[model samples]
Target chain A: MSSPKAKVLLVGMGGVGSVAAYSLEYGGKAEVTAVLRSDYQTLIDDGFEFESVDHGKVNCFRPTNITKSVEEAMEKYGPFDYAIFSLKNIPDISPIEPLIAKCYTPEVGILLLQNGIGIEKPIFKLFPEAYVMSGVTMVSSTLYGRKVVHVATEHVRVGAYDNGKIPYEKQVAKCKKFIEIYSTDKNDIIYDENVNFSRWRKLVYNACVNSSAALTDCDIGRLEVFGAMDPIVRPAMREILAIAKSDGVDLPEDVIEFMIRSDDGEWYPPSMLVDMRKGNYCEYQVILGNALDIAKENGVPAPVLSCMYHLLHVVQMKTQEKKGKFVLPEVRPLPADNFQIKYLN
Target chain B: MSSPKAKVLLVGMGGVGSVAAYSLEYGGKAEVTAVLRSDYQTLIDDGFEFESVDHGKVNCFRPTNITKSVEEAMEKYGPFDYAIFSLKNIPDISPIEPLIAKCYTPEVGILLLQNGIGIEKPIFKLFPEAYVMSGVTMVSSTLYGRKVVHVATEHVRVGAYDNGKIPYEKQVAKCKKFIEIYSTDKNDIIYDENVNFSRWRKLVYNACVNSSAALTDCDIGRLEVFGAMDPIVRPAMREILAIAKSDGVDLPEDVIEFMIRSDDGEWYPPSMLVDMRKGNYCEYQVILGNALDIAKENGVPAPVLSCMYHLLHVVQMKTQEKKGKFVLPEVRPLPADNFQIKYLN
Candidate 1:
C-alpha cells in the first residue's frame, strides 16, 4: 500500500516561520498549509516578498494553503501529520490553547520553532497525550512591513521533546523526517538527540545578546564598541551558564568565551530588539525570567541575569504601555520635602 | 573691612549654578561673580530669567560679575574668596583643572555644588592648599532656554571634604560660612560633618533613580508602575548601601525602602534622563561608576549597581555619539554564515 501523504499546518508566518515554510515547500515533500493572523490578508493576497542571501529574491511565497484561524485551517485541511507553531514567547499578549486544541490530535506531532526554553511545557500539559517537540534556529530573519522577510542565517536544529515515554529511536525518526521536510539546498537542518542542551545553549546567547540589544538600543557588534561584553554580556552569560549547570546541564567551560568570540565581528539586532523597535513586547520572561526561576530553584545566584531580566521587563512593559495594551498606574507627584534630607539647622 | 565682602566666583551657571548664584546674591552676603560659558552672553546681555517655587520669579539675576571664560573671569575678577563650581559631571566633555587653576588660591575655598561622587578629587589634587568643600542638594532645577532656571526644591547640604589635615571644627566652620553665604530665607542650607558619607548617600539615590529613569525613559514615579522598585531600584539601592557600608559610612538600613516608598507618588524625570533628552552626556560615571569602583575596591559585590552602570555607560556613550562628540569604534559586519552550524544531509 502507498504511504499516506504527510500534511503540515504551520502557524505564525513571521520572519523565522516564513523562512521555514519556504524551506519546507522548496523540498516538495509535504503538503504545507500556513495559519497566519494580522498579516493573514496581506500574505494571502500578495504572498510573502522574501529576500535572503541564500535565495536572492522570492517575490511571492503563497503557501499551498492559507487560513486566518486554526479552526478554518483545520476545517479546510485537518488531521495533519505535523502542526508547527512559531511565535514570540512573550506573556500576557495572546492565548495559545484554542489554536493548539483545534489543530492538535493524538497522531499530530507539534513542533515549536521559537526562541527560549520551556515554551513547549504548557503545550505538553494541554495535550499530554500528543506528540510535542521543539526546534531552535540560529537564523537571522526579520519581517518588514507585512509581506517582506529578510533572512541572513539559515541553520536550524530540531528534536522531539522528552515525553518520558517516547523511545529515542522513535523520537529521532520523527524529528529526522521533519528535518528532511524542512531542509533545503539553501537551508541546513539537523536533528539533535540532546534538544534540552541545545535549547539551554541557545538561551545563553539569547539571555545576553537579545536583552542587551533591546535594553541598549544597540546592535550586536556595537556591544564591543561600548565594551558591554566584559561588564554586561559576559557576566550575564556566566550567570546563565551557572544556571544551566545547576539544571544538571554541563555546558563547555569555553562556551562563554566562544559566544563572545563568535560575535566579535558580527552585528545583528536580535528578534527581541526588533520587537522593541516595533513596539511589541519581548520574550524577556521566557528567555530570561525562566532561566532566573530555574537558577533560583537550583539555588544558583544569577544576579547579572536577574538585573538584565528586570531591566528588560521594564523595557517590555513600557513598550506595551506605548502600544496601549498596558496602562501604567498614575500616582500623585510627591511633595519634594518628603524625600528626606537630614536637617541640623 | 567687613571681610572684603567675600568675593565668590561661580562657574558654569546652569541649573544648579544659577540657583546657587541667585541664593548667594539674595542672601546679600557675598560678591558673587558667575564665570558662565555658553550662558555668559545671555547673562551679560539680558541676565538670568529665573523662576522657582521658593522665589516666584526673579526677572533678572545680573551677578556682580559675568564672564565667558575662566581666564576672562580670573583676569576680570581673580583671587576669589570661594570658587563655587556647579557643573554636570560627564567625562571627555571639558576640563575642570584650568578653571580651578585660574580661579583658586591658597586662601580660596572650593565648594562644588554638584550631583555626584568623586568630583572633587581632581580639584583636591590640583589645589592641595585650597580649602575644598563638597555639597549635596535635593533641589530640582533645570535651565530652560539659555537664561531661565526653574527650581522646585531648595535644600542644600554643604560639608568640607575631609582634607586629612583640616580639623573637623575648621572644616565645618568653612562649610558653615559657605552655606551662610549661599543660604537665602527661600533656601534651607545646612552644614554636615560627614560630607563623604553624605555624597555616598546621595549616590544611592542618583545611582538608582537617575540611571533608572535615563535608561528606561521613564520618570521616577513610573518606576513603581513598571514594578521597577522591587526589581531594579531597590536592588541597586541595596548594593549602593552595601558599598557605602564597606567604605565605613554605615548608611541607614531603611534608606533603600525609604527611597522607593518616598517616590510612591511623584514622577519627576531625574536629571540624567533630562540630560539624555537634551542630547548631553549623563553623569553616569560620576554617579554610578564611582560607586561601583568603590564597591570593587572594598571587595563588595554590586551586581545590580554594575548592571545599571553598564547600561548607563552605553546610554551615555550613545548620547555622546548623538552630540557628535564621542565617535563609536567602527567594525565590519560579520559575514553571516560564520556561526558554524552543522548540517545533516
Candidate 2:
C-alpha cells in the first residue's frame, strides 16, 4: 500500500524550523506549510535559500505555502498532520496559546523544537486534546536573510511528552518519516519512556555547556578541552540531576556521559550565546526560568545555575535598557608607528 | 654636584624589562646591567633587539654582563644604584627570596615592574635595608625570541612604596633620573603617598579589562563593538572596585571612568586578552589572584570577580596540565563545511 500524503506545518521559519521543513520536503515524506512572521509577498517574490554544512547548496523554486498569521495558515492549510513549533520562548507563550488553540487539530501532533526542559508541558496543557511530543535537536542551523544555513549535522531525539504512550502507530510512523529526512540515524527516533528525563538530560547538557560558553565567551568544544567536565559540567549536572529527581525524572549516567563525550566536541555556541553576542536578550526566562522553577519546586539548590540565571537576567535587562543607545566606545587606536627589531639590537 | 653615573641591574630579560633597559640606555641616563636566566654566551651571540612602535628599529649592544644566577649578578653589578625586578609570580617568591637577600644592597633601590598589586611589602620584609619602590608600565611590549617588540607608545607610572620614606634619597634620585629618559610629562612620574593605591588602580583596570578579554578570547577593540563591555566589564568593575575599597585603597571615580571609556571611547583589547589568544596564561594570578586575595583579606564580597577567577583558573590549570602531559583530548573542530552569515539572515 502506498503511504498517505502527510501535511506538515512548520511555525517560526527561524534556523531550526526552516531546516526541518527543508528536511521534510527533501525527504519526500510530507508537504511543508511554513508560517513565517515575514511578509508572504516577499517570500513569494524572493523565495528561500537552503544551504548546509554537509550538502553545500540546495535551492528550491517550488512555490512555498507561507503565511504570517496562524489564522491565515489555518485558513489555507488546516488539519496538519504535524505542527512543528520552533518559536523562541520570549514574549511568553500566552500570545501563541490562542493561535495554537485556534489552529491545532486532533490528528496533528505538536513537536516542540527548543532549548531547555519542561516548556512542552504548558503547551500541552493549552491543547490537552492534541497530541503533544517534545524533540531535542542537536543540529546547528542559522537563518541568514531569506536563507537558512545548516551549519552542523547533529542528532535529533524525539519522544512522547511526559512519557505518555507513543501516539497511535500511524502518528509514530509519520514522526519517524519526518525525522528520517534530516537525521542520519533513522532508528535514533526514541520512544522514550520518560520524556522529562530525556528533556532533563538535554537541559543538563545545555545548562552546563551553554551558560559557561556564553559567560566565558568560549566555544563548547573549547570548554570541555578546558576541563569544564569537572568543575563546571559535573557541578551543574549534579544540581540538574537533583532537580530532575525531585520532578520524578531520573537521568541515566550513561546519557550524561554521552552528552559530554560527544565524538566531535567543539564549542557549540548555543542560540542564547548567539543572541548575547548580537546584543539581543535571549529568552532566559524560558531556558533558565524553567530550570529555576524546577529547582524551587524540588527544593534543590542550584548555586551555579542560579548564578548563571542572574547573570543572564542582568545581561538581558541591561541590553534592553541600552538598546539602540549603544555606541562603540572610543578606544586608543593601534600605534601608527611601526618598529623593526634587528636581532643585534 | 652631579649624581654619580647611575648603575642599573635589570633582573628578568623579558619584554618589559628589556624595553625598560632600552629606554634607560637610549635616554643615556644610566649605565645598564641585565641579569637574565640565560647565560652570557647566548646574550653575546644574540644581542637584544628593540623594535619601537613609534620609531623604526634600533639595535644597540651593551657588554655581555648577563648571568644565570642572581648571586652572580650581585657580584658583577651589585652595590649599584638600582635593581629592577620583573619576574613571573608562579613557583612562589620563596625561590627568589634568598636571591633577593643576597643581591640586595642598602645603597641600591629596587623597582618592581610586574603586573597586579601588592608584591612590595613582602619584598620590603625580605630586604628591609634596601629601598623598595613600585612602578606601573603602560607600554605594550612582547618578546619574540630574543628580540623585544614594542607595540604601543604608552607611558609608565613610578612611585615610592609606602609613602616614599625608604630613607634612600640618593637611590630614589638615581631611579628618577633613569625613568625621566622615557616617560613624558603626559604620564606623571610623581611619588604618591601610597604607591599601593596606584598599584590598586592599575590592578582594578587590569582585572576588569584583561580577564574579560582573556575569557572572551577577543581583542580590546572588539569588546565594545561586540557588546561584551556591558556584560563582562560592568560587573567585573563593580567587583574590583569593591575589593579595592575594602583593601583601604580608594580608587578615583575618574580612573574607573578612564578604564570603561574607550581611549577615544572605542573598544580596545588589553594585553591579557592578546596573551590568551596566543594560548599563554598571562597575568591571571596578578589580576584575578590579587583581587581574590584582597577580597578575602578585607572581607569584601566579590561574586563576579570570584566567578571570573574560578573560570580563568580552570582554563589556565587545564591548559597547564595538558601541556605538562602533552595529551590533549579530541575536540570538535570548527565546522569548515558551513558558512556563517555575518549579518541578519
Candidate 3:
C-alpha cells in the first residue's frame, strides 16, 4: 500500500522540531518516529501539545513510534526512507553519526530541518549516497516539556544539497516526493532554487536580531521599538551581507526591513535567548562560527559579528561550566610580595 | 602665615571620592570638605575607615569639614579655593549649577576626578571663567555604607582643560595647587601637560576592558586568564586608537597589554560592573556615548564600539527600568481578525 507510506524518523525535537514532526504526521503520507531523549518520560506520560494557529490547538502529536534513542527507534523500525534532523547543528555536543548510523540506509533522503549554514556538508560526507537536503524555518515559538506555544507564522524553505553521487534529476525527483509528504496547505513549505541564498538571507536575521536579543536581554520586538535596531541590528546585518557577498551570495537590501517588521509587532524571544535563559547550550557554532570562518577565509572584516561571537562564546563557556560539561580555568594566584598599594603603603 | 589652608570642597564621596578626600587632607595643604547625601548619617556616626598598605589601617579621614550638601557646606565654609566634582560626571542625574553655584566664585578650580572624554566641554560651557581640570584615576577599591576597603594601586593623572578665558600660566598653577593638596606619597598623582591626550589614552583602557567586563560578567583577572581579551578588548582598543588618530590624538600600542596584565593577576571588578550589580546607573554616556559621537563626527567606523555602545545602552535602559527611573515602551499589538493560517485553512 503506497510503498509502506515512506517511513520517517525525527530527532532533536524542540519547538521547531516538534512542529516538523506534527506537520509530517498531519500530512498523513509518512509514518513518523520521534526520539525523545531528555523528556522521554514526560512526553510519554503527558504527550505533546501545541497551541498553533495552523492546527488550532493540537492536543498531541501521534508519531507512529516514540523511542529514547535513534538506535532504539531503528531496532523498532529500521531502514527508514527519510531521517530528519531537527536539533541544533552543534556537532561538538551532538555528533551526526553513531546516533543515526544504525538507522542509515542507502537512498534514505536526509532532511535538515534546522538553522545555520553548512549543515548539509557533514551529512553528505558521512552518508555519501543519501540525498542531503537543508531546510530553513522561521517559526516564532518556544518549547517546554512536551509542549510548544507557536505565536506567529511558521514558514519553511527547503532545497536539496546537490549530492553528485546521486544523479541531479533523481535528487530533484526525491526532493519533490519528500515535499509531497511534508507539505500541507497550512505548513507552507516551498522549494528554494538556491538554498544558500535563503540561508545567507536568513543570517541577516539570525546573526543580527537573534544574537543581539541573546546578548542583551532585549527581545526582537522591544529592540525594534526601542533605539537598538539601527545601532546593533542594521550594522550587523550589513556585516553578514558583506560576508555573504564574499561567499558569492547577494542578499537583498530590504531584507533588513523585511526581517525587522515581523507579523504584528510580536515580541519574539529568539531561540538563542530562550536557550540561554534555560541554561541550554546555544547554536552559535553553526549560526556564527561557520559564517565567521568564511569571512576569515575571504579576508572580510566582521567586527560586529566578531564582537558578538566572542561574547556569545564566553556565555556558552559559562553555560557549559554550569552544566558541568566544561571547567573554567582557575583565577591565577596574585603575587604576594609585589606590593601594589602605592597610597596604602 | 600659610594663607588660610586652601578651602577645597569635595562632592560625591564614593570609594574614589573618599580616597581623594583622605589624600587631600593627608597631604595637609587643604582643609577638605566632603558632601555626603546618601551616607551622611552613617559617615558622621561611624566616620571613615581605610585598611591601607600606605597609611596602615587608617581610621577616620580628618577633612576640615563634612556636610550633607554642597549648599550646606558653602553656607558653613564659603568661597572655597577649589570644588572637586568627584561624583560620576553624570549631569543628567545631578545638575551642575545650583548645587555648586552658591560655592562657585571666580578662581575656584573645578577638578573632575572621574572617567570620560569631553567632560570639560560642558563645564566650560556653563562656567567659562573657572579652571576645569580632569583627573583620571585607576584605583582598586569598593565603597560600602561608610567604609572603604582599598585593595591595590591608586594612581591619578591631573591636567587642565585649557580655559582660554583664563591665562594658560594661571590654569597650570591652579592644577598644580590642587594636585599638591590631593597627593600624598601614596596617592601617586602626576600632572599631564595635555589632558586630552591622557583622556584619550585612558579611554584605550576604559572603552574596551571596563565596558566588556561590565557587559559580560567577567572580571579583569578572569578576562585575562580566559580568551576574551583578544576578541573584545584589543579590537575595541584599536578602534578607539583609530578614532583618536582621526581627531589628532596618537596613543601608544602597548597600552592594551599594560591595561590587561594588572598587578599580579588581580581581580578588578570594573566600576560599571559593580554599578550594574548594585542597580545603579552606569556611565555609558561619558565612557562610550561621547566617544561614539566623536567617531561619527570624524567619519571613523567604530563598529565594535558602536555595537558595544548599543548593547550597553539597552542594558542601561533595563537598569533604569529596574530602578523605576525610565519607562519602557509597550509592545505593539497584533492584528485582530487576519486569517493567514495556510496549512489549516
Candidate numbers, best lDDT first, in rank order: 3, 1, 2
The C-alpha lDDT values of all candidates are 0.78, 0.66, 0.78
Query: Candidate 1's residue-wise lDDT over A148-208, tens digit each?
Result: 5555668988888866666756766777888877887888788877777999998878899
Assess the local accuracy of residue A258 in candidate 1 as a C-alpha lDDT between 0 and 100. 77
- True-contact fraction in model 2 equals 0.24
Which stretches in model 1 have alpha-carbon errors above 4 Å?
A1-4, A146-153, A165-170, A329-345, B1-4, B146-153, B166-171, B326-330, B333-345
What's the residue-level lDDT of A177 in candidate 1?
81
- Per-prediction TM-score, chain B alone: 0.90, 0.79, 0.90
Q: Give every prediction's interface RMSD.
A: 6.9, 11.4, 6.8
Q: Please tell me which predicted candidate would have the highest DockQ against the true structure.
A: 1
Q: Which pairs of residues have clashing backbones in candidate 1?
A: A334-B266
Write candidate 3's Cα lDDT for B1-345 as tens digits: 766678889998887888888777777788888888887877887788887655668777546787988888988986789998878755545556656667778868888888888777876666788788888887656677667877766788889888798898899999998887777887688998877888898888888887887777677765654467788888889999998888789988887777666534557677787877777777888888889989999999887888888888877766655666644436554334332212211
DockQ comparison, 2 vs 3, better candidate: 3
**Candidate 1 root-mean-square deviation in Å:** 6.5
lDDT of 2 at B248: 83
Tens digits of per-residue lDDT, candidate 2, B115-182, equal: 87666767766666556667787767777766678877646677666424455565466556646644
